[model samples]
Target: MTALTIRPLQPGETDLFLSYPFPRQPELWESQRDYVALLAAKAYRPEHTWVAIRDGVVVARACWWTGPEDKRPYSLDWLEAEPGPGQVELGTALLRKAHETMRNDEGRKPDYHLFLPPGWRDDAMVRVAAEARLQTARNVDLALFVERYSYRWSAEQDGLPDRSDRLEFRPADDAQMLVVLRQVLDGSLDAHDQRSVAEHGLDRAAELQLEGLYWFPSPRDWWQLAYTGSGELVGVIIPARNYDMPTIGYIGVVPSQRGHGYGAELLAEMAWRLNDHAPGEAVGADTDFSNVPMVKAFARTGFRITEEHLVLTDTAAGK
Candidate 1:
């Protein structure tokens, strides 16, 4: 039997980080690289990665990520094992070690999180956590893809059905945009689509679902704002294309504006812009499974659930 050890990655070991390989969904894989690059550019430290090498061969991999200002200390993003005996043990060992080490770090006691295929819901690691009485957080990652569902969209969908009498649409400037975003902060949390920016207390998990949507590297021009004729901002749409494929990112409406059918309008407009700017074979978007209104809104705009994902969080005691 070959022995395995978990340790921090050396500077030159980036090439052996073959958790993402060529033949398997290259675009999304490349997008992960792009996302890592973006985080580095934003000054995110590269931590929470470990490799299990046996006889000079890297047979398993596990990794996590942290957000700005060290919030959400450990977020597990990817985990994989090359086929072989004891692969799961190797991978799971690396995961436990990585979390344990991060918990002991002096800087902060951050939360550890992982996303696994639904089948792993009963994995031993989960059982260990239960036995240890560790805090656990759960959320879903809903998927929309063209492969399994037909889509139909138009500017005149049920949500934004041609309000010819009262409102105008325009690209918002930074100052005006901030005001609109501030209004959205409350609604954002209410919708479970924002991140917890607060520190030093029990952090609300409301924004957990919105993390990916907000993290995307979409330019400002891709965002659109809807306003009343008198200039009262009602809603906003962040129509970002995925780095890997044709897709839309976060879209939100203020609570004060929800019943006006603005949500569907924003989705349709975003789809229209995506169709106009970057035509592709298909488009994709994701939502939290618990977020029924948002999911239903997407479905009304012709999106269907294609895959399911989970965002798991584990809180480690501070050293």
Candidate 2:
């Protein structure tokens, strides 16, 4: 048996990386090509791309990328191994080696993202493949933190529910938004935020939320504070544009006001706002699978589940 060599992609090895005739069964070759092109355009560092070789033949590969306009690496974006008798082992070893090479001095593991079909859990073959991938990730200490269900609502899906006259949405400044965010942080069901609060504490979690919202490309007018007829704050809705399409970035009802049917109303208001802003473009949103209340709210607002994602992170499970 030939020993496997795990190392970073060498300079000018783009052609070599793209030449490996890896099976593209699960992923379209075009999509894979686009990813490689994106990495190249973004000037992805050679150290961030890794490969596994056996008998001088590339067997597996992985890569990472930084956030838009940011230099530090943000996520592990792509990973694949040629299908063969020992593909699983090769893939797992390649991933582990990549993680080791990329970890910060503080021992923080980079977050990795993977999108899977919604039915992967029920189908036996998909389940097996998904599990193998997950197990390989676990070998490098990346564990599944959350499963997010992707939803999108277009004018064609179903007519938006009539706006409730009882609910009024008023533009909120950053200060006001932060106040609302603090309220929603208490006992939040959002898997990402929940984990953030558990591992890093409430203040840090809130800080991250504020930072994300502050950097949102949409105008401040797109953010709103939902209030009842009597002017009591019910929740907040952030309908912002991602790149080009409008998206329901964040919507949450305060813990004290939850379960009073405010979630559906908040979501409906967001959809109405986006439709009025763009008329016909699709509005997208994602919610943690465990967040049943929010999921039902999305359904009520005419949002359909279009995709599912498995979000894996290097953070220790629940701290």
Per-model TM against the reference? 0.59, 0.85
Tens-place lDDT per residue, model 2, 1-319, is 8898899877778776676676554632223446555665663666677888888788887777654565556677577777655667888888766665576324566777676667767877666656666777887778888888888898766788767778888987777877888889889989888877887787777777988876567787888898888989998888888653789988889887988989988888888888988898898889999999999988887888877777787756322
Off by over 4 Å in 2: 3-5, 9-13, 27-33, 40-47, 103-107, 243-245, 276-280, 315-319
Worst 10 residues of 2 by lDDT: 24-33
Query: What is the lDDT for 258 in model 1?
Result: 74
What is residue 292's positional error in candidate 2, in angstroms? 0.8
What lDDT does candidate 1 reach at residue 75? Answer: 47
Model 1, 261-288: lDDT tens digits are 6666677677767666665435667666
Task: Quote the lDDT for 202 in model 2.
Answer: 76
For TM-score, the strongest prediction is 2
Query: TM-score of the candidate numbered 1?
Result: 0.59
TM-score between candidate 2 and the true structure: 0.85
